[model samples]
Target chain A: MPYVTVKMLEGRTEEQKRDLCEKVTKAVSETTGAPEENVVVFIEEMSKNHYAVAGKRFSDQ
Target chain B: MPYVTVKMLEGRTEEQKRDLCEKVTKAVSETTGAPEENVVVFIEEMSKNHYAVAGKRFSDQ
Candidate 1:
């Protein structure tokens, strides 16, 4: 089985996430020769405060 | 700043995940020319049953 995970900042529309999942699953299946039935995709959304960059939190960015 | 998130199956050792986070952060920093201090990485583990592909759950795969 081929499992894929995507992590991004919170706030994208559900439609965007759905599209991303579908596209990523398709791409991984094609690239890895994994069965479409064996491809699993998961998404995680990080809050602005929980994420940071350049010594500042995402909320500050 | 760049924030990176990784989602994967729940069984990887903490050390493995740490390595992956480091490698991915490095890769993104190099490719995007983002500073190392600007990179933030988060990992989320999905239970096998919480992820699926085609018509089957990852646990079934």
Candidate 2:
């Protein structure tokens, strides 16, 4: 089973997330050859203060 | 690029998360030989209401 997760900033509409889940599931299934039903997609939203890159928090930028 | 994600219920302290990241990174490196610095560990905390198993939400249980 190929479990895919998309982590990004919060505030996306429900419809956007639904589309993302569908598109990402298809992509993963196509590339990995996992069945569409077995490929689980998780969406994780993070606040700016909780996300950091290169030792710099996004909220600080 | 071996990226490991530890998804669990929220409310873990910062210290706990830091330790989890370190340990998980070490495990991934030992198993996959991805360098410690190159192995990224992401801690995703989800609320009970947001998590579901077998089509049943944790909050519902």
Candidate 3:
């Protein structure tokens, strides 16, 4: 399976994030024909101060 | 740069998620000394019916 990383603003329940990981793992497993366990998913939560785009901070956008 | 994917239950401002993409891109660039433009990130949203783990559906868990 392909390595996956999820970046987002933090605020979701653990259950929701966990579900995401599972689903993504399954999708990669099915699409790539790789073992589910081999698929690695990384989650990163960003704060407003840490992200920027289009010459402005994400929180400001 | 490494390929990244973010999997989560849907419901975030586009700005918030876009900021995430930028931050992660920067982080990977800084850490690996890769070109920022070379990094790729994918975002996937999951529904309750699509994800499961630990012998239970994600929504059930």
TM-score top scorer: 1
* Stretches of model 1 off by over 4 angstroms after superposition: B1-38, B41-61
lDDT of 2 by residue, A4-38 (tens): 87888899999999999999999998998889999
- Could you say which candidate leads in DockQ? 1
- Candidate 2 per-residue lDDT, tens place, B1-61, comes to 6766567899987656655666776777788876666776555678999999999999999
**Which portions of model 3 miss their true places by more than 4 Å?**
B1-3, B6-61
Residues B1-61 of candidate 3: C-alpha lDDT, one tens digit per residue: 2457756556656766676567656655554445778778777777766776667776786
Please give each candidate's TM-score. Answer: 0.53, 0.51, 0.49
**Candidate 3 on A1-61: residue-level lDDT in tens?**
2457856656656766676667556655554455778778887787877777667776887
lDDT computed for candidate 1? 0.74
Sorted on TM-score, highest at the top, how do the candidates line up? 1, 2, 3
Clashing pairs in 2: none
The ten-residue window of minimal lDDT in model 1 chain A covers A49-58
Fnat values, candidates in order: 0.30, 0.00, 0.13
User: In terms of docking quality, how is candidate 2 classified?
Assistant: incorrect
